[model samples]
Target: MDDALVVGGTRFIGRHLVAELLAHEYDVTLFNRGNHDNPFAEDGRVDHVEGDRTDDDALEAAARTVDPDAVFDCVAYHPADVRAATRVFEDCEAYVYVSSGAAYGREDIPKREDETPLASCTAEQATNDSRDSYGNRKAEGDRVVFAAADDGVNAMAVRPPIVYGPHDYTERFAFWVDRVRRFDRIVVPGDGTNVWHRVYVEDVASALRVVAERGEPGEAYNVGDRRIVTLERMIERLADTLETDVEVVYAGSRELAAGGIELEDYPLYRDHPHIVSTAKLAELGWESTPLSTAIDRTVAEHLESGRDGRGQGPCRDDENRVLAALDYADR
Candidate 1:
C-alpha cells in the first residue's frame, strides 16, 4: 500500500483531504495534537500520530515512524515551519504544501500559478502582523518548500481561495447567510462590485487529491471555481435560495475601513476582484463544483445543523453596540 502522512489532518480541508486519500486506496497516517476527535474515526483506514509540526524532535520522530511515501502538509503557515519539516522529512517521496492565493503579492495582478513577484515578508515580522502577513508568510513558505525539493523528493504547492463547506470555521460566508435569512436589507461594502473567486471545500479536497496523484514536482497550482460572482449577486443568490426578499445597500470601503470594520467580517469584502485563474489545474484534469450548487449545499447543511441557535438569540449589549456602530457608520 502506498502510505501517506498528512500534517494537521484533524480539521476543515485537511479532514476532507484525508478522506479523499483513503478513498483513493492510499494508506493514511495523520499527525495532529489529537486534542480534537477524529471525524473519520469510523473509516478505519487512518493511522493517527500525535505530534506538533513546530516541534522538530517530535516531528522527526513521527516522520521516522510513519516513513510515508508522501507528506501532505495541510497547515504550514510560517516559513520556519517549512524549514522545520525539511529538516525532518528530507527524503520523503512527495511534499505537498497547502498554500494560499494570498501568496501572490500583486494586488494589481489577478493571481495565477505562473505569476512572478511573489509577495513575501521576513518570518520575524510576519508573526506580529495580521492583515497582510498571512499571504507574505505563505509565499515564503512556498519558496522554502519548493527550494527544498530534490530529485527523489517531489514538492508541490496548492493555492486555494476562500474555501467553504460543512466544517467551515471561518464563518465568513455563514455571517451573510444568517443576515440574509433575517432581513431583506443587505448592507454591502464598496458598491458590491468586487469580484470573488470561491471554491467548495469538497472541490478543494478533490483538487488536492488529483495534484497528489499527478501534479508536476516543484509546480504550484491555483485551485478555485472559475466563475466569478459579485457581492450583490452572491447575496441575491442567497436571498433567492432562502426565498427571502431583501434590499441591497452599498457602502464605501473607506467608510468601513475607518469604522474599524474588517472586510472579512462581512461577505461583500470577499468579492473584491482578486480573482484567481485555474488554467493550470484544468489542464491537469481537475473539475470544480459549480458556485450555485456549492452555495445551496452549504446553506442547507448549515441550516440543518440547527447549530444556528445563536442566530435567533437576543444580541448581547456589546454585540448590539458594534452592529449599531457599523450601521451608523455605513449609513
Candidate 2:
C-alpha cells in the first residue's frame, strides 16, 4: 500500500507511528479531532481531516476523502467504533486495529495471541475505568474487523501491553519517572513484584505498521519485550537510568486504600501477570526494544522534553501522608 490513513496521529504512539509511516515512504493522512497540536501540520507530505472519532459522518468523509490503501484505527474503543470504522473505510484495502492486551483479560497464565480466553465488551464498559470492560470491548472490536472479512476488509488486531515512551498522555510510566526525579523517596503502590511487560511507544508504532503492511487479516498479534520486569524492578530501572539511589517504599493495597489508588496509578502495576509473547509478531520481522535500554531512553527523552506538563504520581500530600504513616508504623 502506498497510502495509509491513520485514524489518530498527533500523540504518543500515534505520533511515532506517523513518523514510521513517513519513513517507510508511505503518503500519510491523519484523521483526528484536531484538538492536539500535530508537529506535521505544516508539512506538505501529510494531509489532515479534523473531526471526532465518534462523529461517524466525519469519519466516513475523511475515509472517503483519503481513499487510502490502508487504514490504521488508533482510537477505536467500542465495537460500535469498529462498526463506524467499517462504514467509513469500506474501500480501504487493509485495516489495522490497535487493540490492547487488556482485551486478553486476566488469564491465569501469560497470554499468547491465539490461546488466551477473552472477555466481553460493552459501550458503557469501554468508557469506564474498569479494565475488564475495556479489554472486553477491545476484544470485541477485534472480532468486528475479523467478522467483516466477508466484506473484504483485510484486518488484524495488534494487541499491546503497557506502552511507555516520550509523549505519553497516560503518565503511567511518568508517575514513577517523575516521582523518582522530584523526591528522595518513591512509594511503589503494589507488593512491588507484580509481573509486567511493556513495549516502547515507538516499538508499538513500528509493530502496528508491520501489521498494517504485512499482517494476516482476521488474526491478532501480541507484541512486547520478552523480558518481564516487576513493578519494583521498573522503578529501580528508573533510578538506575537516572543514576540516583532513591529510597523505595512499598505500599500495597491496604496502605493506598484511602487515596483511591488503583494499580493504574503505576502504568506497569498489573492486576496479574501481563507478560506478552512477541513470537507471533516477531516472525513478521519486527522487534521490541530491550527493557533496560527502553527505560533509559524513556527517562532521557522525558528529561530532555522538559518533563513539564507531563503526568506525576498522586499529589505529594497523599503520597507523603501514606509514607509518614508507614514510617510511624515502622518506628
Candidate 3:
C-alpha cells in the first residue's frame, strides 16, 4: 500500500484531506499533537502518531517508522519548521506544503505562481507582536520546502484562500452567518467594493489531492475558485438565504481601526481584500462547486451540529443585539 503522513491532520482542511486520501486508497498515517479527540476513529485505514513538527527527533523517528511515500504538512508556519521536517523526510517521494495566497506581495500586478516575488522578514530575532512578521515568515517557510526538493524527494506547495465549511473552528464565517440570520443592519468595510476570494474546505482538499498526484515538483499552485464576490453582495446573499430583512451600512477601514473595533484581526484572514486568479488550477482540470451551495451547506451544517443553538431554546433576543453590534462595526 502507498503510505502518506499528514501533519496537523485534525484541522479543518487537514481533516478533509485525510478523508480524501483514504477514499483514494492511500494508506495514511496521521502525525499530530493528538490534543483533540479522534474524528476519524471509524476509519481503520488511518494510523495515528503523536508528535510535534518542530521537534526533529520525534519527526525523524516517525519518518523512519512510517516510511511514507509522501509527507503532507498542514501546520508549517515558520521556515525553521519546514527545514526541521524536511531533514527527516528527505527520502519521501513527495513533500506537500500547505501555503497561503498571502505569500504574494500586495503589488498592483496580477499574481501568478512564478511571477510574484516572495517576501520575507530579515530580523535577527523574532517578536510575537508584529503583524508584518507573520506573512514574511510564511514566505520564508515556502522557500525552505521548495529548496528541500531534490533527486530523492519532490516538493510542491498549495496556496488556498479563505477556506470555510463544517467543523470550522475559525468561527469567522459563523460570525457572519449568525449575524445575518438575526435580521440586523449589516456593516461593510471600505465601500463594500473590495473583492474577496474564497474556497470551500472540501474543494481545497480535493485540489490539494490533485496537486499531490499531478502537481509539478518545486512548483506552487493557486487553489482558489475563479469567482470573486464583494462583501456587500455576500451580505445580501446571506440575508436572502435566511429570509431576513437586514439593512447594510458602509464604513471605512480607517474608522474601524480608530474605534478600536478590530474586525480585521479575525483569525480566518477574512479581513484581507484582494482579487486572486485561479486559472492555473482550472487548467489543471479542477472544478469548484457553486458559491451559493457552499454557503448553504456551511450554514446548514453549523445549524445541524447544534453548535450555534439549533435546539436549546427559543433563539434569544440578546443574540440579536450582539449580531447587530457586529453588523454595525463591520460596516
TM-score of each: 0.86, 0.89, 0.84
- Report the lDDT tens digits of candidate 1 across residue range 1-331: 3999999887789988888887888999999888777887776778888888888888988998999888889878788888788657777767788989888888654677786567868747456547658989888878876787643457788899878777776676777788789765656766777777777888888888788778987789988877777778888988988988998766555545544554455553654477788899989899988878888988997797654423332223323444466677668
Tell me the lDDT of model 2 at 72. Answer: 89
1 against 3, candidate with superior lDDT: 1
Off by over 4 Å in 2: 122-132, 254-267, 306-312
TM-score ranking of the models: 2, 1, 3
For candidate 2, list the clashing residue pairs, or say none. Answer: none
lDDT of each: 0.77, 0.81, 0.73
Task: Give lDDT tens digits, candidate 3, residues 1-331.
Answer: 3798989888688898898898888999999888877787667889998887778888887898899988899988777778887778777777888888777766533467788877755753122425567667667767776787644457788888677788787676776677678646655555666565778888888887777777777778888765667777777877777878887765555544444444453223244465566778777788887888877888888777655532222233433444455567679
- Give the clash count for each candidate: 3, 0, 2
Q: Which of candidates 1 and 2 reaches a greater TM-score? A: 2
| Top candidate, metric TM-score | 2
After superposition, the stretches of candidate 3 with alpha carbons farther than 4 Å from their true spots are 123-131, 150-152, 253-272, 306-331
**Candidate 1 TM-score, true structure as reference:** 0.86
Candidate 1: C-alpha lDDT: 0.77
Give all candidate RMSDs, comma-separated: 4.0, 2.7, 4.9
